[model samples]
Target: MNHRRVGRREVLAGLAGGGVAALAGCLGVGGSDTSPLADHPVAEGLADQPTQGPAVGDATATVVAFEDPSCVRCAAFHRDTVPRLRSELVDPGTVSYVLRPYPVVFEWGEAATRALWATYERDAAAFWGLLDHYFTDQDAFSSGNVLDLTEAWLTAETSVDAAAVREAAAADGFPAPVQRNLDVGEAADVTGTPTVFLFRDGEYRTSASGSVSYEFVTSALEL
Candidate 1:
């Protein structure tokens, strides 16, 4: 993996190229390394967030999706590509989906933590429901309102009364699993949101970023 410094301009522009190539060349890794996905290992110590659908599968492919809730691209990917995969790939028992939170954007980390917390507190279905809420109201939770809105969403979802999330965010202690995600992303050379890794038979086969199409992911999994 390349650790070369990426320019502030490229980082700010959100260039959708840099990391591993999984599908359609859209996946973005964090660093400048050009290594293939087969050479990399999933990052270590990512927080244990509630995840859905590492569904029972015949072929048994596990995908670790690195996402930040505040990223519009992530939302778009879920809205477009994920639904297709859920129906055709995941539901049929061909894939196991593991969602890992990456806190590239500060606000996103807060949202990710709260969202995962809600999922853990509630259930997988409720997690997606709350996620849908966030996606529908993406603009409502900005940096200024990150903690407040995240807490509100969690409260509504889990009906929990604890103020720990808000307090943590205020003290910059929220996004409980941020360091783990950061470590994993750094190790995997993940640079941006929506980066995905497809592991088959315990071997890394491919990776992708951005709004990858269902057809593309389907093809990659075939390898």
Candidate 2:
């Protein structure tokens, strides 16, 4: 990876400031064949980090996305790009898609991430739905309301126990898997939401920061 390695102090400072802003140029663009992928690395040991995030497809080529639930740019990617990625890359088995919650953009992000992991533990399939829900309704959440909002959403849209999810979200500290996600992001030098890393046949290929188009991903994988 060509990413810069920062000391723990730098990482903490970055996190304290909510990291870097999303690349404005990369946001709100639909998938276009003209878009280009950046030459970035997935960082050593990042591929092996434990994650409770949901995934799809079974291809050897994988696209791992590190995102914050409350990030508007990440929401744009989820709303506009993810469906095409699923249809053309993931559903077709050309690439596996994984989402790791980084929760760096907003104060409530960690709570929302905890709720997501709770949903994943109860029903893996429901995890994706809940994630989409959070992204789709980002304006409705806050640090004070994230857990309650998640609880209500889970009750209405899934079979998982809502109270349990709320409890998990309201817990005192980070869950082990969620902490691992933070570690992975820190190790990868992730500075913004919607950072994506690509791997082909278990070998790191490239990465892109901010919203990435399906075309960019396919071009990177040489598809």
Candidate 3:
């Protein structure tokens, strides 16, 4: 909870300046600054999206993950580490997992995030499924045919017409939620993709970022 907010470059600098210990300190190690997660402030018609877990106050622990739909690292993390997190933490009823789309690399991530939420608004269950599709087949959506491809994938998943997703992606104000997420990230001092905040027993324990290994998740939860 230092909340000293470091950008990605600063994260790398910490590693170079003082090795793992510096990075560890930056990640809230041995810190007494216990604070709750901030309520993300979104503009009207841009409320926070539904989280991918049980109701907030009903879990023993919660892992709030911030990621960019277009980030390769986020995709890699989901592919490699999510299964372990599911088996060890979520499936056992040890914690609830919450995924937030934090826009980065605006070229594609912004629109991608918008389409993701729009899909969620239409069909909640299909949201996670499409997230899997987007991550695994990122190249398909990154093309000039992103909207058409996304629509097709979404159409294959649910009854909701994905044409609305395309509309949401192109709207002039589409960046509201993404901007709000960036604000939340700034407040949390998050500077990278796949950043996860671990809250246990109603206390903020720590956070991890990047394509972190399963060990990091397990160890953070252990505390």
Candidate 4:
């Protein structure tokens, strides 16, 4: 139960600029010095968050991913690398992957919330399936059509009772968690979406922002 709960202010701060991270690092908050990321809390019932808790590997290594749905880089990471990670590592239980939604911009925040609700109301498979659709069509939503595109995307995804997902998204049920995620990201000195953290053997390592290759991530894994 030693999980770090991220706050929205931190998330927005990181999205706003890199100054916050510099300050956090100077303050020793983002360093390997006793920060929550360093401690690597055990997240329970994480299925409601984004994806499930890592599949629980024997090597005691865990992957924590922070992503904003509207981020093209995040989409690229999903497309370019995550699938391989899933097949080669996550699915095989070599690593436990925990995803935290770090919704920075408003459009992405709404989508992230909808995705959370989709996972809660539908199922994990449905939620990820919808995520695949989102990444595939990341360019479809201009600022003028965020909600419209999101609604259409939800409607097209299976496993979700689209009506209910949209209802929850409109109502904004996942705001608190999303906000918390933002806060944690900022505190950890994350400058962008797709900021990843790998925890193994009581140590935490950070990844370069955006679509990092599987080789780099795997090489960092302590296993």
| lDDT of every model, 2 decimals | 0.60, 0.70, 0.66, 0.60
**Regions more than 4 Å wrong, model 2:** 1-23, 26-58
Best by TM-score: 2
Candidate 3 local lDDT, 1-223, one digit each (tens): 2222225455456556865443332343323235653332211122255564555546777777878777677788889988887877676677777777776533466677788888888887887888888789886666366777778887876877788888997665455555556666776667667777777765676777665777876776672
Cα error, candidate 1, residue 180 (Å): 1.0
lDDT of 4 by residue, 1-223 (tens): 1123233455456657764543222212122332333344423333346544354334356677877666666787888889888888777766777777766544555654555555555677776776676668877755566556666766665645666666566663355555556555665666556677776654566445555667767777644
lDDT of 2 by residue, 110-198 (tens): 78888888888888778888898988999999999998888888899889999998999888666666666676677667766787877
Overall local distance difference test of candidate 1: 0.60
For each of the candidates, give the backbone clash count.
Answer: 10, 1, 0, 12
Lowest lDDT 10-residue stretch of candidate 2: 29-38
Q: Which stretches of candidate 1 lie over 4 Å from their true place?
A: 1-10, 13-40, 43-49, 55-59, 106-115, 118-125, 174-176
Candidate 1 lDDT, 34-94, residue by residue in tens: 3433456563442264445564223467677877776677778888888887787677777
Candidate ordering by lDDT (highest first): 2, 3, 1, 4
Better of 3 and 4 by TM-score: 3
Q: In candidate 3, what residue range of length 10 has the lowest lDDT sum? A: 38-47
Q: Give the clashing residue pairs of candidate 1, or none.
A: 2-33, 19-29, 22-207, 27-208, 27-209, 29-191, 30-190, 30-191, 43-184, 57-93
